[model samples]
Target chain A: MTSPTPAILPERGLADRLTALFWRHPRLLLAVLLTPPLLWLGVVYLGSLFALLLQSFYSIDEFSGVVKEEFTLKTYAELFRAQNLDIIIRTLVMSAAVTIGCALIAFPIAYYAARFARGKWKAVFYLGVMLPLWSSYLVKVYAWKLILAKEGIITWAAEGVGLSMILNAILAIPGIGGNSLSTSPLGTFIVFVYVWLPYMILPMQAALERVPTSMLEASADLGASRAQTFRTVILPLAMPGVIAGSIFTFSLTMGDYIIPQIVGTSARFIGLAVYQLQGTAGNIPLAAAFAVVPIVIMLIYLTIAKRKGAFDAL
Target chain B: MTAAVEFLRVSRHFGPASAPVKAVDGVDLTIAEGSFFAMLGPSGSGKTTCLRLISGFEKPTSGTIRIFGQDVGDIPPNRRNVNTVFQDYALFPHMNVRDNVGYGLMVKGVDRRTRDARAEEMLALVKLEGYGDRKPAQLSGGQRQRVALARALVNEPKVLLLDEPLGALDLKLREAMQDELKALQSRLGITFVFVTHDQGEALSMADSLAVFNEGRIAQIGTPAEVYARPRTRFVADFVGSSNVLPPEVTRAFGGPMKWASLRPEMLRVTAADGVALAGTVTGIRYLGAGSRLSVALNGTEVAALLPAGQPVPEPGATVGLAFDPAALHVMEGEG
Candidate 1:
């Protein structure tokens, strides 16, 4: 028996035509999909960073003190001046201190939440960590300023508890201590740690959660002490999370000028100096050069962290 | 010798008091020293949970557990003289295999030289001599299993616990591992307590096996003994393939109780020999080694394993099946 030939439809739907084109050229389709976001990130965000870096290389005019369009290392050379170097060091030290403090405090909290804490308690802990973040950052910084004031609740409580002497003793230290914690480098460090702590805790909790209960049991079964198991099994495994959290603490502390402005005494941090240079002094090249310090430091830090396998956990 | 591990009415309950999930309920077991013991069950039968209890990972809701006559009820898992090979291997992903294997030694403050030597020795023992420098992610699934075994065995604990260590491997690789584990256990002269849902693995590898059924041990005996005689209905069905005769079928020939079980291999079939129980072959399955004939007998069906090269009968052909009196395993009690 002869079968009748069927006629093919000539007109193609838009979706069908696009699908056919995509099917025929998958890589082109992928490029089409990814182009917009990649274009946005590459041009808008990274383009400014690249431009800022280029601006750092321009020379500062000797007489006019204005940024010269000519490229030179004069501004970069000024970065090594003693006072500028001192501010860089101060910022570095503070960033390290805040990162360490955040890690120390965040780890125990994350450990408890991930391994042992139950339903309602886990939610409570999560809310406690996250709830503070919903408030304005400036508000929290100001609150810390009030809390650390000479006539603040902390000093009053310290005095009431006969701990004022201890507080004064702590305030007498050379670099970190000052008249009052509100007017101290120590207070800035504390505020930085407080602000970035949630960033530390969440990553730590996630990393700890990925650690199988079986491995912990395995460690125990192998005749290791509780401390030994934690040292050998838990801590080494949690390093990635610590490194990830350090990224937050370190970068946040390094870049923030606001906390130092409200809470610090006489010390100038990298961010504050950079702000003064760019805004008040109109030394864009020098400010950009100073800004390159944190960027360079973070690049080095991320490299070291990557070597230590931090991104693997992420 | 005294048992290496003992569970005295152990039970672990989770969730609210009103309706707790009984992961392990009043389990009393004695594991012999230097023997390969298996806790066999289907998923959620509490075998792994029982292993956890023995390893001190979980506290029993009631009862007590002892290791080498010492009560370990209050001991944390790290203090226990037992090592576990986790199902997922649980090798430290951050550490090289040498470090992973030697972790317990390092924890004990063993010097680096001694730890390295022992880890090296363990690597060689698992046939992964050069794999010591590699990471867990760098190794294949089977190689990772070996690394886990080496890690647990390196500690030389009183007993080693393996939680479905072979569950992740392919069938061919799993078979090879089962033999390796048996050999390793015997050579090391260490008590091994492993859990698995695979009946064939349990039967082949266990010196003594316990069948777990819904948080309780259904039966415990040697592989041969359990297979020859399963004491409960659950065991008769779950331990291996068996034709569980219905009450009507048993009563048709006045054989036994409301529930009786017969191993498929134990039954013999004949086309026209006019055996006591007569039936028609409803279905025929041609397995490589032998064939399984599904017979429709008096309101019930039973399976009989026919040897290869037999004169096969077509479907719907009349047939007769017979078995020895001892083949009728009376499945009694609530399993």
Candidate 2:
């Protein structure tokens, strides 16, 4: 059989010609494919980050309340002042608490979903984790606010169950407590944990899924009892996912102004401080400096986590 | 003396109760102390499941499992005193080779120094003395396999279970590891229960082996005995290439009217004259060491293994096959 020559071959369509051209110059096709997302990342995301960083370097004039465009460490030095330092510390503590809380609560749920949930149960688990996320964030926060209020179902239930004294005792604690549950740091914390839990659960579930059943079997077969196997094998293997989940919870809690503003004490968080300073107070440099705190904290956190081999599993 | 491991009519089922998959069914087995025992079968033949039952990973539905004469009912895998070298060599990827090897000791609350020393010693035993610092991911497949072995052995369990430990290796590496494994088992004097699908691996490494079919043990005996005289068609067909003859063929060869097994190597193909059985040569396959000649006889096909340097017969030619009368093994039941 004689093969058809190019002269007698059918003409190629535009799509075919483009495919042939792409097949010959693969790098050109890659560049074409990557251009849109690369531009979005480089210009919009990183460009804004660089602008914020540059803004943080400039200082606000004390008397004129005007931002000086020149680079100076004066605005950064202002961050060391007692009142501003209080907001930073408070935000840091809350972020850590929320992250730890999310982790503790998410682990068992994620473990159950990863190791046991199958077919219909798996779908139900995913729905349970993601159901709250489908609601608007502000709506969820406000709903939590109502749930934690003085006349809310929790307080009523506690009273009905003869546990109101315990509830009152918890609310009577100094810095976290307020006149009502809606006006307490604990309420803010509860809302924050509730908001960020799904983020924690999904990553943790994915990490736990990657842990082979054979690994657990091997560990048990080696004479490591259930608790020992959990400590040495399961926990260490799940650390990366925990760390990944913590990144979301920690950073989100740090930057959230709305939750604290609506629920907590009159004292402010870093996000609220940044909001007030940049808007009403017109201290853009200080606001930018406040925003940089979570970034710097996360950098240190990631470094420590990496050293502990958290990303190794990831 | 009590067997190292014993199963009394164990059965394990999976999925729904209405029509469950019987992974293992009514299996009774015993492994002698300090013996290298292999469970030989194809995939899903229940050999691996039986190994898991011994290791306490899977519980038997209807029977007791005794390890070292102790009924291990409801005892978890960790307390069973048997360790498994998983098929995929499930060495902890997060830990270094030393830590992985010493995990059992560490979990037992042995001090760091003792764990380190014992781990290093086990690594040396596996001929991987200097590779302790590397992660499992850092090592080659065979190295990881050795680490898994060291990890399991460091526990010093009464019985060691290997689930196709050499299945992942290449032919050369697998053969070398098989010899090393046999040597190690004898030297340690620990009971070794190995599982494999490869008949050659089972025949070579095991002191005694069981042939599993479906979910039951078809036969169990020493390599030589099983190879020379398989009691069933499945054993003869699976263990090695054998010419299974029907009852009519057995009768034609002046044997009792029963199913029979004839080893391929026992038959000699010649010109179709004055022979016990005559057939047309259907196929000739070169096997480097010898040739396999398939002959159609008595309404069924039989193969003859021709040694190297023999004159090969062409297909479509009628050939006579000769074998000693005693070589035809009469099986008890129909396949």
Return the top candidate by DockQ.
2
TM-score of chain A of 1: 0.89
Off by over 4 Å in 1: A1-13, A16-20, A117-125, A159-162, A306-314, B272-275, B280-282, B311-317
Which 10-residue span in candidate 2 chain A carries the lowest summed lDDT?
A2-11
Give the interface RMSD of each candidate.
Answer: 2.0, 1.0
- Report, for every candidate in turn, its global Cα lDDT versus the true structure: 0.88, 0.92
What are the C-alpha RMSDs, in order, of all predicted structures? 3.2, 2.0
Model 1 docking tier (incorrect/acceptable/medium/high): medium
Residue B20's lDDT within candidate 1 is: 99
Which digits, one per residue and each the tens of the lDDT, describe model 2 over residues B1-335? Answer: 66999889988988787997898999899999999999999999999999999988888877888998899988888888798999998888889999999999988899999999999999999999889788898999999999999999998989999999999999999999999999999999999999999999999999999999888899999999999888789998999978788889889978899888899999987789988789998999999999999899878889899999999988999999888889999887445
Best by lDDT: 2
Residues A1-314, candidate 2: write the lDDT tens digits.
Answer: 77666555564799888988999998999999999999999999999999999999999888998788998999999999999999999999999999999999999999999999999999999999999989999999889889999999899999999999999999999988887788899988999999999999999999999999999999998888888889889988998889889999999999999999887775799999999998999999999999999999999999998997887655
lDDT tens digits, residues B122-203, model 1?
Answer: 9999999988888889899999999998998887889999999999999999999999999998899999998999999999
